[model samples]
Target chain A: MKVVVDGMGGDNAPYAIVEGAVQAQKEYGIEIVITGPEDLIQKELDKYDYDKSKISILHASEVIGTNEHPAMAIRRKKDSSINKALNLVKNGEADAIISAGSTGAFLTGATLIIGRIKGVLRPALAPIMPGKNGPFMLIDCGANVDCKPKNLEQFALMGKAYFETVMQVNNPSVGLINIGSEEEKGNELTKEAHKLLKEAPINFAGNVEPRDIPLGNVNVLVCDGFVGNTVLKTIEGVAGNIFSVLKEEIYSSFKTKIGGMLLKSVFSKFKKDYDYKEYGGAGFLGVKSICVKAHGSSDAKALKNAIRQAKVFYDNRVIETITEYIENSIADNDENIKAE
Target chain B: MKVVVDGMGGDNAPYAIVEGAVQAQKEYGIEIVITGPEDLIQKELDKYDYDKSKISILHASEVIGTNEHPAMAIRRKKDSSINKALNLVKNGEADAIISAGSTGAFLTGATLIIGRIKGVLRPALAPIMPGKNGPFMLIDCGANVDCKPKNLEQFALMGKAYFETVMQVNNPSVGLINIGSEEEKGNELTKEAHKLLKEAPINFAGNVEPRDIPLGNVNVLVCDGFVGNTVLKTIEGVAGNIFSVLKEEIYSSFKTKIGGMLLKSVFSKFKKDYDYKEYGGAGFLGVKSICVKAHGSSDAKALKNAIRQAKVFYDNRVIETITEYIENSIADNDENIKAE
Candidate 1:
């Protein structure tokens, strides 16, 4: 399978991105197509020799920086690496696409170039949270800010199908994140979404509070973009703060730092468990091609993980399962709507 | 000044609540009125030898537990301790009210009995957040489920006045809590609130993220009740989880437990610094009288802090300052609206 990598994105562009592609080609036995300025990409690739036959170069002259707007770049920058990489996956040149670039840029390109499945509304990006109950999927983490109740119901349906296929959970429970775990807890959108979710022929667990999120009380956590984004960011902020404090404490004194050496291996495992890079990036589920976006600061290791994730998406037949579920669910919804 | 205290509130009520009232009477010299079942309160008080003349009892026959619906109790359970305590403040029989009961019950009573201030569109419950730079006021921590842009603007005005009287920070900087500090980030409400907050008379910083909260980056943090509640709860969850993990590590073995004992004094200081009880209680601003609601599981110490907070609120004339500020700011808004 051919995987297209965006070599002109993220904080550590060209160098780490290109290195990751080289390492993946050697390890995974898959054709790796690096997309960026042909000269710079070739120059980076020359620094390391991998399996020559497993890698190729795709030329994309233009680059989108971190400061550039997503939709603007997608519309205007014709030869941007993001656009080129996504286009390769759409036009049967690549099996899947991966990017460690601007989230907005990658999502914009993925939506416009790759397009969505037939019956899907807005595409949602679900990040698998590394929690105690394996990894729970939180959909619409920040894709659509202004969501109707109908949009949330659709998210739950897609999320359930993804977990069933990729994670292999049998009838995974879907939950709506609310203020409290009661029928009458959330605001207007959540209140209406609760109704739709209950009747959507899924294992709906009603409402789940924020406290239950880290505890991994449910498999698929659903919410509108506003609430979902805040939840994701809060977890990120708290986790980051804790790590920073732990790092300082581990090095504040000679004794603690020495003690840290004794526990270095242990701490490394802990960091690995919480790291988003290990999750193989957040998959854009509703898009036609399996376009996964890694964190902007992804290194070689994270890029490898993102590529591995694409394989899981392909191996588990995620796209075909999601298509079938969406068709049947929409047909039922249409019938129900018409009757009402 | 007369301060009404709920006798039958909290997990350890009557005995602990009576002890707290006795301590407050001796320490703060404020007349304490215990409101609950008169017989139980009298029995608890009879066991304690103090100046009985300084304390009085108000009879309330019914009590609501944590499991009861807040709205149903407010409508049906008329003679509850919370309602009676609030009524005392409403009728001006007491200067303020304190309760460590169910939050929903306390909020219900405060809104229905104690009443909201004049011209206040929505009354927000402001909580004192412990930070490195002291406490910053986070209004709308969990009051309004659905907030418009105007409600956020009101939170800023009330939070500004609160800092003036309580924290005594001159021209405290107000911030709209958003997904990111970047200008174009956050949901629709925050984007709209950004414009209004910038025009506000108080020192207005544009947008602040969740991570910025602990650093005290802004004096006031404003958002809708849903987002605010999630942020607050998430911080609590993270802090609690980390502390527990550390505690287990420190006290895992007998030798480590001995080390913990050796550092017990230092650890106690850390516990006090981290404890929410030391920060007083949450204040129901924009109400007629200052109403401080402690945690439902409050011990004697948290109750004492709430009483202390009430005295400070009375001494600094918090209500008057908030009233004066709101009058001036909204008048400016009225003029701007008329001009347009």
Candidate 2:
């Protein structure tokens, strides 16, 4: 399989992107097409010794900034790295696209260029968050802020399909992220979504609370993007705050400093377990082609992990599976709505 | 001011509740009315040295369990401690009511008995969370699951009034908790609420992200209950998960164990700062009478803190202030809506 990588994306840009692509091509035996200014990408590539056969670069003049409006940038900058990389997948030159750039830009580009799967309302961002037992997929992390009940039902189907095919979680239990675990315990959107999910064809776990997320109670937790973004950001903020406070306390006294020194490795392990790099990137689901978004601050290892994840997505044909599942499921619902 | 305490409520019931009331009377010079089986409350109160003239008990025959449906329990269990305590406020016998019991039951009882402020659409659960600097109030934590934009605007006014009068923060700023810090960065409810908050007579601080919560960016953060509950739970879950993981790592080796002993006090201070006990309880704002919901697992210290919080609220006439503020602000909005 081949993956097109946005070489000018993320904080560590062309260096990390080029190095990650080289490492992925060498280890995973996947062909990679890196898009960026040719000179910058080539300069970084010279530091690594790898098979020249599997690696290639596609030069692009413009770069879509992290701060720009997504749809505007995608519409105006046709030759930008993100747009060009997405075009490679649209043209069947690559199996998937990976970018650690602006999430909005990437999603907009993917939807406009590659297009959405047949009958998909809105493409959702599904990021695999590390939990106690393992990892669970959180759909619509920041993709669609306002979602209808039908959208949430579709998200559950898409998330389940991706989890089953890519992560190999068999018949993954799908849970709606709600304020309470009881079926009748949420806002109107969730209340309606809950009923829809219960009747849908999937392993529908009842409403799951945000508190149960760290315990890994469900394989696929679904919610509208606003709630999902708050949950995701709160988790990130709390984890970061706790560690910073711990670091300050560890340096407070001589005894604590000694203890910190002794437990350095343990602390590192714990931090690594919570790091976004360990989980790679969030997948932009519902698009016709596969698109994965690495974190904006991703390093070489994170970029490599994202590439590996994209390969797994490509090899398992998860996008095709989701499109077929949603097409079938939504069609029945459409007919039911029509009959009523 | 006299505060009604549910003597038969919470996990450490009768003991923690009675003890906390006794402590509050002795320390804050506040009169307390303890409701339950009088003999059981007396037995617990005997363990502490407190002013007999300041503390009194009201006899009640039944108790509301944690697992019962809130509305049904309120209707059926009229002789319960929660019902009797709420009746004290209804009969003008106490200034405020505090319960370390089931939140749903407390809310149901308060709304059904004491009623809402005349112009207020719904009461909001506002908890003062301990942030990096001081404390910030998170409104609508779990009161009304579904809310209108007008309800949120009223919540912000209620929250602002309480923050200024009770918490004594000068010109406390109210911020709309959103996915982003931009004006147009939320769903329909928030987008409308933002405009309302901006126009209302309060210190509207614009939009705030969940990640900025720990840094104490705003005095009062307003949202519908679903989003508020998720943010609160995410904070609680992340804090608990981090500590549990740290505990496992701290005991992994002998050096770490020795280091843990040295850092024990430092860790305790950090934990204490983040503990729910320090923040006392969540106040049900927009109600005609003050109602505070202490955590279900509250101990003596937590219950005592809650009693102290109720005293602060009573002394400042926060409930009355909020009632007046919201009555004026929402009446204007209601007129505008009617005109349209």
Candidate 3:
């Protein structure tokens, strides 16, 4: 199986991305296809060599920057690295497409370019992270921020399938993230979504609070993009902001600095506890293949790990399982929609 | 000013709550009135006394537990400790009431017993938490889980008043906690609330995500109870769960166990953080008098800190300021509603 890597995607493009692809091919024995400017990709490829036959490059002239609008870029830059990489997956040239560049561009390009599953309402981005319980999937983390009740029900269906097939959790428990656990709580969208999810043909875990994320309360978590994004970003912001504060405190005085030295190893371990990059990377759930979205600041190690995760995702045939789940769920999903 | 303490409230009832009240009286030079079984309150009070004249015990027989239904208890136990304490505030026998019992019971009694201000749509519970910019208040944390656009607009007004009084900032920046920063990114309630707050007579900073909370992006955060509660609990859960996992890892092996011993002091500092009790309790906003809600598991220190916060609330005349703000906000709020 060949893995398509966006050579122009991410902050350290052409260098870290190229180096990461080479490391994965060498270590994991996977065929790699790198997409970007052919000349720049060659210069980076010259830095690494075990077998030139193990890796290939696809030429693309344009690169999407961080500030570029995702929809606009996808529309205008049809031959961009991200689009070229996705095209490889669409034509079955590659088993998956991975990118660390603009999330919007990847999401927009993946759906509008590569296409969505037949019964899928909207393709969601599901990323699993270390929750209070263990690893839990947060659906629509940033995709479709303003969701309708029907959209949330669809998110739950997609998330349940992904968790069960990819994560191998049987009858994966699906929870609607509400502000409170009570039935009458949440805004209009959530209030209606709660009723819809309960009636769907899935293991509904009822309502879950944001705090429950860390506790690993359920296998699949569903929410509108706005709330899900807030939860994911809050976890990141709280973890990052606190660590930064602690660093300032640890070096604020001479005695504390000395104390910080004696406690350096523990602090390093503490930093690892809250680091999302340490847990591989995020998955773009609704895509046909095993495409994953690595963090923009992903290093070589994280990228390699993400590549391995994508291989496992492909081997699991997650798309086939999701298709079956969707087919089985149509009657119930439609019933809930009509009922609500 | 006299502060009424519910002696039968909290986990370590009569002891911690009573002792905390006695300490407040002696240390802060405030008159204290303890409400509970006369005998138990007197017994706890007898443990310390710098001035009996400064402290008084009011008799009440009923008790409220953390698990009890708050509204039912408020209605059934009219002479309960919470109601009795609130009566003291209502009758001008005490300037404020402090209870660590059921939040529902306190809020119910505070609303029905002490009553709401004229034209105040809902009484929001504002909790001041540490943020990036400093301490910011999350209004209506759980007082009302479901809210309308008008309710949130009024919450913003009350939050601004709270900051001016207790937080003491000139026109504290108010932000709505939403999934995205865009006006149309939220569902019906949030979208309408955005329009209302933007036009309200206050300094509105627009929408803020959960990540912004840690960065201290906004001073007074207004959101319906569901979103606010989810954000509050998620932070609480993450803080507790992450620390515990790291602690377990440190003690999992013999070598790491020894490392844990040498790292005890540093770990203690780390532990000091994840401790939610350290951040003084949440305040009940929009009440006629200042009221602080401590965690159910609060010890003496937590209770003491909560009381200290109440002192600031009382001195600032937060309720009076809210009254003025709400009175001024009605016209703009109505116009916003009509425009929507």
Candidate 4:
């Protein structure tokens, strides 16, 4: 499968992205198409010894800044690396595309340029986060800020499909992130979404409180982008603060310092488990083509893992499965309406 | 100062609650009225040695369970310990009230029985959470589920008053909790609230992203109940999960076990810094009288701390400050409208 890489994306653009693409090609033996300034990409790729035929470059001069307005950037920067890369998938020239650039620009380009899948209300960014029991998917992490009850229903279906196919979890349970577990215990949006989710075809686990999220209570946790974003960021903030505080405490005393040294290996292992790099990228679900948005601060290792994730998404036919799921659900709704 | 304690409220009710009252009475030299079944409260009170005049018992025949509906329990359980304790404050027999009962019941009873401060739109639960820099108050943590822009504007005013008066942080900055920091960002409620906050009579800081909360970016963080509740619970979940996982890892090996034992003091200090017991309880702001909701799992130490907090709240005249703040803001709005 051919995977197109945005050569000018992310904070470590060209250097890290190019190296990661080369590494993925050498390791996975997949054909790679890098999009950016031909000379810059080639220079970065030349630093490593690899099969020349396995990797190719498509020249694109303009690069979208992370601070640029998302929709405006996508529309204005026609020859940007992300735009050019998304075009490859739109025209069926590549199986998938990976970008670590501006999340907004990438998600906007994937939706407007490549278009949404038929019957999909809106595309969602689903990221699998590490939990105590295992990893679970938080859909619409920041794709659609404001959503309707029906939109959440679609997110549940799409997230369930993606988790079941890409992650290979059977009959993955889906839950609506809410303040309380009771059916009548939420704001307007969740109270309505709760009813719709219960009727949807997925294995609907009742409302999942944010406190239970870390326990991996469900395989797929669905919520509007606003609440999902808050939950995701709060977890990051608390975890980072704790680790930093621990480090300071460990160095405050000689005894604790020696203890910290002895426990260094265990700490490193635990950090790796919670590291976002190991999870690769968040998939832009409900899009017509496979699109993965990697962390902006990703290094070569993170980029390589994201590329591997994109390849798996293509191989497992996640987009196709989501499409069928939405279409079938729509048909069932129509039949029920006719009977009524 | 006289404070009323719900002697049958928390998980360790009667025992922890009674002992804590005696401790508070002895340490602070404040009059305390314990509300619960006379025999049960008397039995627990007999275990503690204290000045007879400082501590007294108010016999109540009923108790409210944590699982019962908040409003329903407040209305039906007329003779409950929480109800009797609240009545003591309402009737001016006590200066404040402390309860470790169901949060909903306490909040509902405080708002309905004790009443709201004049011109106050809604009452909020403002909890002083420990952060990296220090402590910050998160207003409307789980009170009003859905709110308008005007309600958030009031929350900001009330939160600022509480922070400045009780916490003694001069002109504490107020920030609207949002998904993004930009003025144009966030959902309908936050966007409008941002505009109102700018015009409101307070030290209005711009929008605060959830990720910055743990760093104590602002002294007062305001949001609707749903989002605030989600953020609070997510922090708790993430912090608890990390510690649990670290413990499991520490015990998995002999070297780490020795390290854990040596570093136990440092770890315990860190835990104490983040512990809710040390912070006392969440103050129910915008109420006519002081009401502190202690943690449901509070032990004797936590209950004592909560009593101390209630006494401080009453001494500082927080309710009077918030009432004046709201009334003046309303008058200012009226004058502005008249000028327009």
Candidate 2: tens digits of C-alpha lDDT, residues A283-325: 9999988899999999999999999999889889998899889
Listed models, DockQ each: 0.44, 0.72, 0.39, 0.81
Interface RMSD values for all candidates: 3.6, 1.1, 3.3, 0.9
Better of 2 and 4 by DockQ: 4
Name the regions of candidate 2 deviating beyond 4 angstroms.
Answer: A331-340, B46-52, B327-340
Better of 2 and 4 by lDDT: 4
Poorly placed runs, candidate 4 (over 4 Å): none
Q: Of the candidates numbered 1 and 3, which has the greater lDDT value?
A: 1
After TM-score superposition, the amount by which residue A15's alpha carbon in candidate 4 deviates from its true location, in angstroms, is: 1.5
Per-residue error at B333 for model 2, in Å?
Answer: 5.2
In the range A257-327, model 3's lDDT, one tens digit per residue, is: 66556556666876775676677667776656777888888877777777877887888887777777676
Give model 1's docking category.
Answer: acceptable
For A1-340, candidate 1 gives per-residue lDDT tens digits of 8899998987888888888888777777889898999999999999997777888888999998767788998889989898889889889999899988878888878888888888988889888887654688988887887789888988988899889988999999999988887787778999999988989878999898887787676999998777777787777776665566567665666655655565455456557756888887888888888888888888988888888888788888888888888899889978988999
Give the poorly placed runs of model 3, Cα more than 4 Å off.
Answer: A50-54, A64-69, A131-133, A148-157, A170-207, A252-265, A332-340, B38-43, B46-54, B57-73, B148-153, B178-207, B249-274, B331-340
DockQ of 1: 0.44
RMSD of 1: 2.4
User: Candidate 4's error at A104, in angstroms?
Assistant: 1.4
The structural similarity of chain B in model 3 to the true chain B, as TM-score, is 0.92
Q: Please state how well chain A of candidate 3 matches the true chain A, as a TM-score.
A: 0.93
Q: Model 4 chain B — which ten-residue stretch has the worst lDDT?
A: B266-275
Query: Which wins on TM-score, candidate 1 or candidate 4?
Result: 4
